[model samples]
Target: MKNAAVMHPKDRPEGSEHNECRALGQILDRVGDKWTIMVVGVLSRGPFRFNQLMREIGGVSHRMLTLTLRSLERDGLVSRTAYATIPPKVEYALTDAGRSLIEPLRILSNWAIEFRPVIEKARAEFDSRQV
Candidate 1:
């Protein structure tokens, strides 16, 4: 008896492409997040302490920044280092993998900047049509 969980890949209709897309979607969900993008952009400059990151990124709440850092760390894109001192200090920096993301992100950023007026005009047209 073949268990559904153990079913062969040949048994699946969507096959490997579906699985590949699902994996890509999960990664996109992480990297495509606004906070993640902002954090990555700031970190690309250099390492930053927690408070420094908050100040530099602006508008990120304490908890949100903490969560975003944790998520980035979990994905191995960012590294966290702690120092022993009277007041313990920690800093966050990008790993090589994270650094590799900068070029693609920069291209995407440039594209968005270039198309902003066009997008805004399209949105206005769409909104007017909806009325």
Candidate 2:
């Protein structure tokens, strides 16, 4: 199926596209990535600087964080604010629609926890079969 981003309504925000499949891919691209969801989950609390996001998300490389943030911003789920200063000031926060994702993420979290054993078993089986 086409990604929702590409087929989304024409009235969508500037950074957002109008194709349904493109939009779907954009969403999956954001949440399906381990780091993007974590970033959004953490940012749901409030805005944070890039370094702060890195600290909060943990184990994420600077490049990956940058990529994730850029993609999220492009998808209209996250916004970037910049301030002029000696070193420059920047922060990331969720848009209202991005905020709406928190509840669904919570549900996904619950599902991950509940099905972890099954998932792990399947993972191990698949890994072993590949050997």
Candidate 3:
């Protein structure tokens, strides 16, 4: 009988590793984007209107915010609600999957805060060498 611990290459689970890496890469690409991270951070504080998100996350343009929210909604990370009125009202909120990203983003924020000085120093050194 073949040893239980030592299976032939063909005996391994089919395409599991490749599929996992591909899926994880796609998720990381989305979450690692700067705009996505910032948008998700603000939305974690509950729903907000378009202008509110713009004010809260300064430096993001109206066009960019619209695109970002639309992408987020398409990805199922956020929900957009529109109210029918003389003046339209819209609000954005995080879905449960989006909420699940908050803790991880917080940890990444802490890491960035702690290492920022080190990174700055490294950047300065690299710049000085670029004569």
Candidate 4:
């Protein structure tokens, strides 16, 4: 049998599959983060200032929220609005691109919920075998 690792000349297109996989991995790393998912889900309700976000997303540290917001802002998934005022107010909201992610994340959330029992059983079985 021919080796699976060897790609035929015709398979080498202008945009290689490896590059596409790398790009997908980068995006997944960001969106798949626990804090990112929670932030996106909460922000889907509306824009929120940093303190409000911290309150809404329980258990997230102040530093982690700041980092997550900065990362989301950098990815164009979230927008930061700053207001000129005595206190210099700021809010974070999902961009058009970020809003588009909501449905997919919801679907994934549902799948995880549905599979939790089965996954727990699997884990129990695997752990039992290790003893």
Candidate 5:
């Protein structure tokens, strides 16, 4: 993490002796939400209007998407632009800080897809023992 500005404490391996390694829990609290990942992933491609985002990311309600974008914008991970038009035109894009997240998020997404089966099996085994 010497070269990086941000280091997620969750990414650290176990058995570390530094108790203060858990300092960036706020970042995790913000970006670790399920909606944030998907929204950011979509925005990483390019700017999108509100309806476009809702369509691209199916199953997210209008209110939820609005809230997600607002939170991301507040956290400096997303930018919102409104154009002066007849009615109004709005778009959302990733800020520089948000762009920095794309690579790390891509890596994490790959890890999730790759390990899903193994994780599911582990969950089943643990669940069986609980009964």
Candidate 6:
């Protein structure tokens, strides 16, 4: 009854499209790092210095945090500033693009937190069945 000759993309508009492959790869690189998500969440509240970030994100090593921040800065998601102060203060802040990702991250975190009990139970059952 149907002549299905064309296989059009269902999710994209006829003329409007994007580089989804590149976008997915870059996004995965961002969220793939646990510390990056934590750092983004921390900075979403506002800017903070190196020490403040260290304090906010518990258990994050100086090296790892520095690396994560550098990655984010390179990706244009975060901006870093340095001041010629007595202690030579440096601070980190999120760009507009980074700020826009906060809601999605919050949603992801909430889902993980809210589903923890169910997820744990499922894992337990799965492990027991495998035994």
Best by TM-score: 4
Q: Sort by lDDT, best first: what order?
A: 4, 1, 3, 5, 2, 6
Cα lDDT computed for each candidate against the true fold: 0.93, 0.87, 0.90, 0.93, 0.88, 0.86
Give candidate 5's whole-model lDDT.
Answer: 0.88
| Candidate 1 structure lDDT | 0.93
- Tell me the spans in candidate 3 whose CA falls farther than 4 Å from its real position: 1-20
Query: Which pairs clash in the backbone of model 3?
Result: none
Candidate 2 per-residue C-alpha lDDT over 1-131 given as tens digits, one digit per residue, 9 for 90 to 100:
45534555654665555355586886687677898789988999999999999998899999999999998998888999999997999989999988989999999999999999999999999999999
Instruction: Judge candidate 3 at residue 95 and give its lDDT.
Output: 97
Error of 6 at 26 (Å): 3.8
* 3 or 6, greater by lDDT: 3
* Per-model tally of clashing residue pairs: 0, 24, 0, 0, 0, 0
> lDDT tens string, model 6, 40-122?
98999999998899999999999999999998998888999999999899999999988987998889899999999999999
Question: Tens-digit lDDT track for model 3 on 10-94?
Answer: 6646775576679889879888888899999999999999999999999998998898899889889999999998699999999
Q: Which scores better on TM-score, 1 or 3?
A: 1
Better of 3 and 6 by TM-score: 6
Would you list the rank order by TM-score, best first?
4, 1, 5, 6, 3, 2
TM value for model 4: 0.88
* Superposed Cα deviation of residue 32, candidate 3 (Å): 1.5
Q: State the TM-score for model 5.
A: 0.81
TM per prediction: 0.87, 0.74, 0.79, 0.88, 0.81, 0.79
Candidate 6, residue 127: the lDDT equals: 98
User: What would the C-alpha RMSD of candidate 5 be, to one decimal place?
Assistant: 5.9
Residue-level lDDT of model 4, residues 9-47, one tens digit each, is: 456665566776788899999999999999999999999
Native-structure RMSD, model 6:
6.3
Candidate 3 global lDDT: 0.90
Off by over 4 Å in 2: 1-23, 122-131
